[model samples]
Target: MDYHNPNYATSLYHFIPSPLFLGKQIAPNAFQTTPKLHILDLSGNAGCLPEHPELSSMPELQELYLRRMQISVFPAEIMSLKQLRTLDLSQNSLQHIPQGVKDMTSLTQLDLSDNNISALPPELGMLEPSLQVLKLDGNPLRSIRRTILDRGTKAILKYLKERVAED
Candidate 1:
């Protein structure tokens, strides 16, 4: 499902090739048409689309899969989906998980494995009591200790919590 090709298969939209050879396209308003769309799986696109398409129109979105999108920047635009419970951003080029993620308090499972993420915002500590599963196994984290990461989600969250307290 490579969005870079535009002809990729998706459960929602069908893409037909246009003569336009636009460098890169970000459909900021694409999701607005389907306001009730809940589970969107855009994984394996391997496309380096920079802008986080504006998906705030869909308040019911519970799960979003942006794995392997080649996304370098954090998709802050779609993070507006406060009801999101599951978010997978694995296998991308992300270097940082923005502090804005703290607003998605409803997230229970967040998969950010296999990315270039170096450090996590201590604000991630705020997701506690709600966030139960966090996948950062394949990332090269700077602030978190390997021992804590090996201890799994609870330990990682605890580390984040402690960092928050120290600030």
Candidate 2:
């Protein structure tokens, strides 16, 4: 799909399937014109994404799904989405969640399962009040014990919060 197509300027939701961006890097301003976009799903697209996708322009974006995008590093640009509620980056190649994630105050759900993350940043605990769901299954987590992870989101958040307090 041609991202520059003016026909998608006011689109609220945009989805691009696999092979469309295969092994290609998404342009930094690919979505710059879609200011009204609320949901963007680029799942199954095995490609390299820019360090910061041009998502800051879409202030109303609530849910973003980049599952199976072959991402290794967390995109810092996503932190600028103040109104985002759900973010799914599952089935990627992420190794760590950046401390900057705390800036996403409106996130209610975050799915980082099936990644390579071995440790989670304590800053994640800051979102306990607003974050209702966090999925970390399928990762090689060493910072958190299996029992805590098995206890579900509440227990996981509590454990992370305790770690933050310790610091």
Candidate 3:
């Protein structure tokens, strides 16, 4: 319907750094009004905000874009979105690939490119059955050779699964 109505706001494209709005701009209870929200873009809001606890409230979200948000800690709360299909956390300061990611069973595409990530969790193998795309380019992965990553999704996933079986 109308964008002004909180119930109708299904998508929000906020380029302004979220730190400026934390606690001051958004009322703590405001997120409850939009239960249908599916897409959220807060890309480029880097450094100022480290952890966003508010995202957990939006369980209906499907596509979440947080590129360059500088979130070092994965918000396990965001994993509450069982409907999530695409998650873009590229170009941030993340180092570890969080375990909670395996719970997003509906995910088809996940982007974690261009970060400081040095290794990956074998639990990533669990996503192979449903995950259609996973972008891990630009990370300094040590365990898996760059040659395997260049071979693409099937190769990378198979390599991770093999590692899991060996462990």
Candidate 4:
């Protein structure tokens, strides 16, 4: 269920256990405030836009979870969070990486698993300089062959080197 009101500061939203939702549109400016709101959890709510109300203008927001939301495109405006460090968009319906994601230089952990993405944008290498953990297991990418994994650190090192050089 969706709740909307100008004076309401904080409220508990319902948990929808449905696996798929299509065509749900959330009001974008319902939680407008001065100090900034932090932490948003929209998991299990598939088809909800990542750029929903209260999320786009939030200045202090740090952690965001849109996993299993069946999102296809990422919003470029989310890059405005200079203080943002964690983002989880796994289990969605994405097919490509959003170009604006490269703007998030402070991100540490990224979860992109369980999606239909087949290839990563070459610019993703730019994130190698700051990223600590990357989750890309469920993608349909066919380039990373098992032989590459057998090569161990050398393979990863080469991948990183190429990524850094690509920048």
Model 1: lowest-lDDT 10 consecutive positions: 8-17
TM-score of 1: 0.82
**lDDT for each residue of candidate 3 in 102-158, tens digit (9 for 90 to 100):** 778899898989988898888787788788899988988898988998898878878
Worst 10 residues of 4 by lDDT: 11-20
Q: Tell me the number of clashing residue pairs for each predicted model.
A: 0, 0, 0, 2
Strongest candidate by lDDT? 2
Q: What is the C-alpha RMSD of each candidate to the true structure, in Å?
A: 6.0, 2.6, 3.7, 5.0
The reply for model 2, stretches above 4 Å from the true place, is 1-8, 16-25
Candidate 1 C-alpha lDDT tens digits along 85-128: 99999988889888888889999999999999989999898899
lDDT of 4 at 42: 69
TM-score, cand. 4:
0.71
Is candidate 1 or 3 superior in TM-score?
1
Q: Scored by CA lDDT, what does every candidate get?
A: 0.78, 0.86, 0.74, 0.64
Clashing pairs in 3: none
Cα deviation of 98 in candidate 3 (Å)? 1.8
Candidate 2 Cα lDDT to native: 0.86
Model 1's C-alpha root-mean-square deviation from the true structure amounts to 6.0
